[model samples]
Target: MKKIDAHAHLGYIGGWANVKMDVDELISLMDTYEIETTMICVLDNEVAYKAMQKYTGRIEGCVYVNPLEPDCLDLIDKYVKLGFKAIKLQPLRHAYCADSEIVDPILDKAEEYGIPVCIHSGHPPYSLPWQIGLLAERHPNCKVLMIHMGHGHGVYIDAALKMARRYPNIYLEMSGMPMHTKIKEAYDTVGHDRIMFGTDTPFHHPTVEMQKVLMCGVDEQGLEDIFYNNAKKFFDV
Candidate 1:
């Protein structure tokens, strides 16, 4: 079955310093691992757009918007019109709380566009599962993709699962999450349809991330759902 990376990024993040992967490098990695598609974002929209244009059908562009920007919603509109299928909100990097007013307009725009909003989860203050849950509760029409599934930590993993179990709109993304038991718990509790594969590439290897899911002992249908079907249906890619 074809695999779709639900979360990925290209280009260096100056703040993190550890994150730095150009489109060429990413494509090489994807090719090595046989990843047919990836939902990716970048620090520079133009670069991302160009890469998307260059690698059309293999990369699904996500409009990575900082809620702190004055024209954030406008930027989102521009990218969406340009063919971005989803919205990526990184509250932690922007130094804003996930539940703050800063993200409300972004969530509103997501509802208007009828696209999935992939939020950075599993951290503190800004990217917790409950905080994302608040957005889901408020925006019932929008689909919320929880990136990291709470960062593979103990408490947050349970929190992520609890939120996914409680909110029908919430989808669990397995990236940066290391526990096989937790992955299995997410599958058993949220059902295979609510789970999607991601690597958060450059931070985690796509093959390693795939191995985490495969080792969970997921059946063929479940593998299909987690690897490609759910994401293809979620983003309409």
Candidate 2:
């Protein structure tokens, strides 16, 4: 079966994680795991842009933006025209509520451009699953990917599933989320295509993430949907 990593980052990241990597490392990791395509969304659009331009089929770029930034609109327009496949938002990092009216413009822009919005979910006071649910509720037409699906907290994880149940447009990504069974649970209850496989590279490993999915009790077709088909459909890879 083929695999498509729904989320990843590139270049040097300083601060808490302190990790650095380029496309070469990403490609090598993918080759080892047989991941056919990956969605790259780092702070610098130029990084993802250059990687996609160079790798073409293997790397799909997602324009990451903090909606509160003044130039976010321009970045979205510029990157969309440059062939980016999606938009990514990190409300936790940017210190803004996910459902803040400030985000509606970006959601509108994503809808207008016909691309999905992948938002970081999990952290409190800003990026909870319910906040993303509110965002989804407000923008019913836009496709919203909840990256990490509420991170490592058990309560947050269950909330993530509940939020997905409430909103059809909200998709859950399995990356840093800890529960293996929730992977199957999400598919069984939230619909098969509503969950995706992501490595959260740098913060997590592909080997670990892949193992989580493999042990999740999802059958072959469900594995294919999570690891390959769902991302293929969402990113148009």
Candidate 3:
């Protein structure tokens, strides 16, 4: 099956303790794990654009912007026109509530441009899964991907599942979840089409993440959707 990583980062984290991801390093890992494609977000828009341009189909760009920043919508439009495939909102990192009015414009632009918005989940008061669901409810036309599926915690997972079940526009990006049972549960509860596989690469090992999916015991069709088909449709790659 052709696998696409729906979530990844190409920048450093936490005072440069982690290695910064680059085109060669990302491609090397993709080659190692046989990942056919990846959707990457970076703090630097120019770096992301350059990486996408250099790697073309192998690395797709996800526009990362702070909603509170001035001309946020303009940047989103500019990057989308430049071939960005999705918009990433890190409410947790940006210190904003996902359901707040400030984020509405970002979500609106995402809908306007016909692209998905991937939100950081699990963190409460800011980026909770339920808060994202509330936003999804407000904008039914928009596609909202809950990255990490609440980071695999039981309480957050329950909230994520509840949101997924309640809102059809809400979808799950599986990564950083530590157990296969959660994957199986999500597949059984939310169905395969709404769930997409992701590695959260550079932070998590691709091989280990793939193995989690493999051990989930999903049927072949389900595996196909999670591995490639769902992301292909969602990201239009």
Candidate 4:
């Protein structure tokens, strides 16, 4: 029970790979990896809801939000009330700025529901760590997970850690990010409790993500906190 993947996907998604995944495939993968729980998001909210229903405890839903759409706010209200655990946003994919007021209403709704928020980080113009940091600054009451903790870039990865240090409400989920040493830097400086392990499934494999943390130079308890305790507590699953 020492693993909980904080960022994962369900259904077919149009991307570089146009990757597709069903619940059974995901469940089998989790079993093979010994992951106790995995938080999932999908382009279609129904898929997430159904998976949650089917698996009960194994699948935790992160209601995906696209702020550019008219129903984005309504979707939050709909899904959160339907038992989705947290809010997931991807600004770059939707062509919106993460720090803009367009996302404020979504953040407000998440606060109302008392759930944590996660946003895709790294990539320019929209999803940079500083941009997400501004949103966190505006809404101090909400918990925000900067997913990827700034992807594969060194500068963005460092920026991600800086944002966490700068904002108390900010937390980091290390998935696509490389650099295992930064995890140690983050744990030693920011706080081990603020960092968590994630596998951006269908995009990044768990082996590399887990290896990053394993080599991050933390103790056994620190590994437990990052792999399981932090996300379990943050998502309240």
Candidate 5:
């Protein structure tokens, strides 16, 4: 079956000794893993744009927007015009919540453009699930994909699942965190189709992430949906 990695990071993670990668090496890994397509984004906009341009066919680019950046909406507009499939936000890195007033304009723009937004939603310094839920409530038209399911902790996962159950616009992307049981629980609660497969590559292995879902004992059709079909439908791939 064909595969599409719905989330991945391609830029340097400063100070985090474990997570570091350059674009060339990432592309090599994608090729090695037989990933037919990836949703690529970088912490740096210029680098992301260049990498997107470089791997135009193989990667569906998502532009990163720093909520603190001045004239951020203009940059988002420019990239969306450049054919980026979505916008990426790191609320935890910035110590901001998803529903913060600062991000309202960004959410508005995403709704206006009819594209999705991916947010890092786990652990310290990141916004919690309630914040993400509030943002989704405020912007019902915008599609929000929660990265890591709030990092798989008990409280965050519970909040995330509650939000996904309440809002049609919210989705949970599986990556980085080891949450096989929680993922299965989410599937049982929200249905298998609501979850999307992601590697958070360079941190987790794509094939291994896929293996987690397989080992969950979901049927072949459920596996196909998570591995590729759901992302295809989500991004119109």
Candidate 6:
């Protein structure tokens, strides 16, 4: 099976414990795990885009944009031209919700480029599932992937499914949540085609997260779609 990890962090976040993995180390890990490709993003946009340039062919990435940054659009254009697959936003980190005025231009650019935008969803003390749905409604053409399905709060699953049902562009990425039965329920409710496999690696081991999906009793075809084909189709990988 061709494995594609839809989410991963490869650089250091300010003040967080160091997680600085160089391109060679990242490539070696991908090779060891037989990961055909990984979508790399960093908490810092400058560092992340540099990494994207360095690992251009072997990996794809999203530009990390803090909506609060005054030059957010310029940075977005820079990375978009550099061939980033999407924009990575962590609302919690910047204390800005997806619906904030600061984020409007970012969403506009995402629509303009026809690229997807991934948000760190389910991380509380931050944005919630309703915000994701609202954003989807506000930017009907923009493709949004909700990371972790709002992890601690399972309520986001319903919101994600509702938005997905209403809009063809919304997608749910499974990363932090570990309940196998809930994952299966999401598959049944939203259909396997709308779900993407993500390990949230470096935080959780890829092998272990991959195993969680494998043990879900989903048929091989379903597994194939979740693990690779769906992401391939989504990002044109």
In terms of TM-score, which candidate is strongest?
Answer: 2
Error in Å for residue 9 of model 4: 0.5
lDDT by residue (1-237, candidate 3, tens digit) is: 679999998867765456567788999999887789999988788898999989999999999999989978999999999999999999988899999889889889998899999998988779888899888999999999999988857888788888998998899987987777777788889867898899887888888889888989998988888899999999999
Better of 3 and 4 by lDDT: 4
Between the candidate structures 2 and 4, which one is better when assessed by TM-score? 2
**lDDT (10s digit) by residue, model 5, range 31-146:** 88767788877866777778778888677778888888897898899989988889999887777777788998998999899898888887654578888888889889988998
> What tens digits encode model 6's per-residue C-alpha lDDT throughout 17-104?
4445666777787788777888877766666667667777668888888988788888889888878899999898889877666777
C-alpha lDDT score of every prediction, in listed order: 0.87, 0.94, 0.88, 0.91, 0.81, 0.77
Candidate 2: give the clashing pairs.
Answer: none
Q: What ranges in model 6 sit over 4 Å off?
A: 14-20, 157-159
TM-score of each: 0.96, 0.99, 0.96, 0.97, 0.93, 0.90
- lDDT-based ranking, best first? 2, 4, 3, 1, 5, 6
Q: Show where candidate 3 strays beyond 4 Å.
A: none
Better of 4 and 5 by lDDT: 4
Candidate 4 stretches with Cα past 4 Å from truth are: none
Instruction: Give the per-residue lDDT digits (tens) of candidate 1, residues 1-237.
Output: 578999998877666566788888888988887789888988677887999999998888889888888988999999999999999988888888888877888989988988999999987888999999887888888899999989957899889999989999999998998887777778889877898899998888887898988888778888888898999999999
Error of 1 at 174 (Å): 0.7
- lDDT per residue for candidate 4 within 32-99, as digits (tens), equals 88798899989788999999999999998989989888999889889988899999999988899889
Please state the error at residue 17 of candidate 2 in Å: 0.8
How much is the lDDT of residue 51 in candidate 2?
97
